[model samples]
Target: MSELGKKIATRESYGNALVELGKEHEDLIVLDADLAGATKTGIFKKAFPERHWDIGIAEANMTGIAAGLATCGKVPFISSFAMFAAGRNYEQVRNSIGYPHLNVKIGATHAGISVGEDGATHQCLEDLALMRAIPGMVVLNPADDVEARAAVHAAYDHVGPVYLRFGRLAVPVFNDEATYRFEIGKGIVLKEGKDVSVFATGLCVNEAREAEKLLAADGIDAEIINIHTIKPLDEKLVLASAAKTGKVVTIEEHSVIGGLGSAVCDILSEKQPTKVMKIGINDVFGESGPALELIQKYGLDAQSIYEKVKAFVKQN
Candidate 1:
């Protein structure tokens, strides 16, 4: 329970990191738009009551408040449901946080169709695309708890607007605290191979790993790259992986359009001419079910990756 364990959520990692980082950085402040409990920022509020602000349910005002605090040399981490933080407060985030490029960290929880049982409205599938469109926003979707904690530290040290996407449902904890390191605008080659590169983020990274095992068993070697930071995309690393593997596949719990897949295509179309494939949500809304069922239905699960990769390997 202390260190990395199986089937852990990123929210828990952020909850622990906020308390740990709050202890060292006195300037670290937290703002929650009535989602202190849900977003797991309540841990920080329990200790640093003075530094934590529960801004009611007004997400737009919360962004303005965070931006205002950033001007005074305070590094504020705003926590709320992803739909509210990124979907509802787009202008506030864009005009206030993104325009000035404030040192505000946004912990956008419950992203993608995996935010099941809450239905499509609550799930923020287009968050990465929205955040990526912002001029100075540094968008991130960590692979697991270890990367989640590490990204929190990196975001704290980073000076600018940061959008952190986390999941509501727990997945396999595939990383170790000691073995992993976080650097902004970089991708990690998890498993090296020469055929196809599976570039993924968020929970899809876990699915991609599982899919890799299936592919490897069939004698199809696949390279896996963890794209933690999406906005300042590591295009060079992506192109290099594509060049080395010669085939690219992107997996994400987001839309096929304007998400991780689109980001990878933007790079490969210019530098590498490798054939790329993507597995993600189509142009449709999510529904109520178990989180895993929703991901599987939306083609954001391991089976989808396996099918897509298998087809790609055959075509190649």
Candidate 2:
């Protein structure tokens, strides 16, 4: 395992990536629903003021505007909290952007319970499930700063509607920016082990990595894989890992029902039929608290994952 680098939020990376892409692609424009600063799209707004639009608090209107921009051959990225971008503007996103198969990128930030003090209403646990249901929508939940920035570039290059999920909390920088490569629908195996395969996405990926170290201390060898792309899931890699280990565990910051865990189960139940375990926000809403404290309360911290996986390995 590589030494963990400084913690940086994926939302920050999303903002930086837009500026980088804006330089190369003049048609790239950013639209935010009165959350430019929080969503980090303000960074892009600063660099290219003319290309950025603040659509007030109207998320649906912003989505419609982005769809219109896509029709004119402009690559528009609509930014907002996940609750609004994916939840409040679902109809517009599905009809205007998704149905038309426009070249629009939806940058949804502050996803999951990690939205912290904002509480359950602001924290969106259903965005992944919602976006994944949309036809022709490419859903991406990057694990770290490097992957988040790379995913932004990939979304800009890919045609059709893309949903990019980002987190406000800073996480461990696991990937080396110099050598890391980000693909649209591929999984990266960070560590190899024979006991079990632990697949993780978003903020949970780094926590899973730390859990792996704890599992190692207890003589449980585990394979850690990063499933950044949730919609066009890397089924090939998923099945291969499950086949190798016969035990699978999926961890995500989103709800267990329609997020990475559910996606993995959908594929495995059909083909591999391996024993699978899901670690995430169960069927419960989150409460207002410190971000890290909320993570621990919800059993999403590194210690919690370690305990759960260790018991899982022992029992099954």
lDDT by residue (89-207, candidate 2, tens digit) is 99999999999899999999999999899998999999999999998899999999999999999999999999999999998898998899999999999999999999999999999
lDDT for model 1 comes to 0.88
Global lDDT for candidate 2?
0.94
lDDT of every predicted structure (CA atoms): 0.88, 0.94
Q: What TM-score would candidate 2 get against the native?
A: 0.98
Q: Cα miss at 102, model 2 (Å)? A: 0.9
The superposed Cα distance between candidate 1 and the true structure at residue 193, in angstroms, equals 0.6
Off by over 4 Å in 1: 1-5
Residue 93 displacement (Å), model 2: 0.8
- TM-score against truth, every candidate: 0.97, 0.98
